[model samples]
Target: MKAIVITSPGGPEVLQLQDVEDPSIRDDEVLIQVAATALNRADVGQRLGSYPPPKGASPYPGLECSGTILAVGSSVHRWKPGDQVCALLSGGGYAEKVAVPEGQVLPVPEGVSLRDAGALPEVVCTVWSTVFMMSRLSPGESFLIHGGSSGIGTFAIQIAKHLGVRVFVTAGNEEKLAACKNLGADVCINYKTEDFVARIKEETGGKGGSTLMMLSSQLASVWYDISVWCFDAGVDVILDNVGGPYLQRNLDSLNIGGRLFLIGFVGGAVTEVNLAPLLIKRLTVQAAGLRSRSPENKAEIVKEVEKHVWPAIAAGKVKPVIYKSLPLSEAAEGHRLMESSIHIGKILLIP
Candidate 1:
């Protein structure tokens, strides 16, 4: 099997395509002949040596993939060698074949191509878990997502809007904002030229709904400004991906009984957060990671996604936005595109 190996911690140049031993399946796992894999920020972090795979996981960087089952473990009952599936993987999706726990594999949605399904698992599960399940973004409520043109953001805007939530988003430019608006965002702010907080205030009448989603790296530098923004218009729920410097301000930004879902730490991990707001506002803070979750837990998320989200994709109400698709050997180029942050959606690697 040929896999994209991280030669060292650094830039895209360090990713090397090399022959590796085919993965052996555990009793409860399935071997997938990977058709495609998708690029994620986690892959970049892993390639740069900041993120490491969990114990007993693949050393390769891909987090999700689409493929056909090549073999099934003795204990696996729901899948067979001929099944067309897409799976949520902890790692090893950057190869020709990957062994995944049976529970993490899902039948590809009807009408969605096997190649495009590679981009679904990560973004769908991440958004569904954080925005809908954890944050409880109810219909008719105002919802704001940072990085509106991102994979997660693009998916989220569609899902939220489909559910009757008035969506707001911030992007780097007009084109990106227009893209988001076309996806049903009610308000789009060009973060480069406008103050998102002020825009939110103006749009929502100074009572920006209790729910917010932060998926940008820029949060680290503007945490204080956001805190001040929150002082004027309180927030309720925050689906925060960037931790570190944003922690304290996240606490400050919430209204009474606000819940914060911490999903990632692209920003530095170490930081000081004042506890006063937690006590005063009775805020609930919880952190979750999909990759390190138990197989049963992942299976539950997969089941929920299939039941609630898959139909949306099947119906053309929501769709995966693909930026580019390159051959598996050009994995480095995918990483380069991700690092450049020029892509508005998922970048795929076809095997």
Candidate 2:
């Protein structure tokens, strides 16, 4: 198997392609012959040495992939060899072959090409699990998302709109906002030119329901102000991918009895929090990683994919937003593109 490995994280130049031993499948796992893998902000952090694989996890840097099964372990009864699948992986997806627990793999939605299936796993899992499952987003609610042109944002806008939620988004520019609008965002905020908190309050008349933000240092400073944008005692639920100082603000922004689900830390991981606010707000703050979930939890997410995500893709109501695709060997370039922050959606590496 050939894979993109980082010798010393600093820049994209650290990534090198090399031949490696194929992965061995566990009794409950299946081996996939990968066709493509998608890039995420985590990959950039991995390349720069800020993020590393969890203990005993793959050193390779892909988070999701689409491929065909070559072999199945004896414990896998429902699927067999030659099954076309897409999977959420802890790591090791940037290779020709990778093995994963059987329950983590899902059949490609109808009408979706094998190569493009790489775009499905991470975004679908993130949005569905966070926005729908955890936050319990309901129809007629107002949903606000930061980085509206991002892969996560694009998928979120479409899915929330499909569920009858009024969507609001914040992006860096007009072109990005227009892209979000085209994806069904009802209110698009150009964070560069306008204040998202003010606009959201103006649009919702102070009854905003949910807010999703990828953590950033600047966002942390204005966190409470942003929460104020959600009228009617602030937002009820927040899905925060970035942690650090924002953690304190996330708690402050929530309405009484609100919930905050923390999933990532793009910003550095040290921040101070006031415990008193948590008690006063009756807030529920939890930090978790999807990659480390139990096999049963992953299976539940896969089931959710089948029930809620697949149909949207199959019916063309949800579409993968691909910023660019490069050859597998250019995995370095793929990471480079993501770091540049010029792309509007997922960048893929096709083998």
Q: Which candidate number has the best lDDT? A: 1
Which residue pairs in model 1 clash with each other? 210-236, 210-237
Each prediction's RMSD over C-alphas, in Å, is: 6.8, 6.7
Residue range 1-351, candidate 1, lDDT tens digits: 999999999989898999999999999999999999999898988998878999999999999999999999899999999899999999999999999998888899888899999999998988887777777878767666777888888898888888888877778888898899899988888867986655655665555444333223355566332222224353555666668966876665555676777878866778976565565567788888888888888888888899999888888899889989999899999988988888897899998
**Would you estimate the TM-scores of all the predictions?**
0.88, 0.86
Worst 10 residues of 1 by lDDT: 223-232
What TM-score does structure 1 among the candidates reach?
Answer: 0.88
After TM-score superposition, the amount by which residue 247's alpha carbon in candidate 2 deviates from its true location, in angstroms, is 5.2
For model 2, give the 10-residue run with minimal summed lDDT. Answer: 223-232
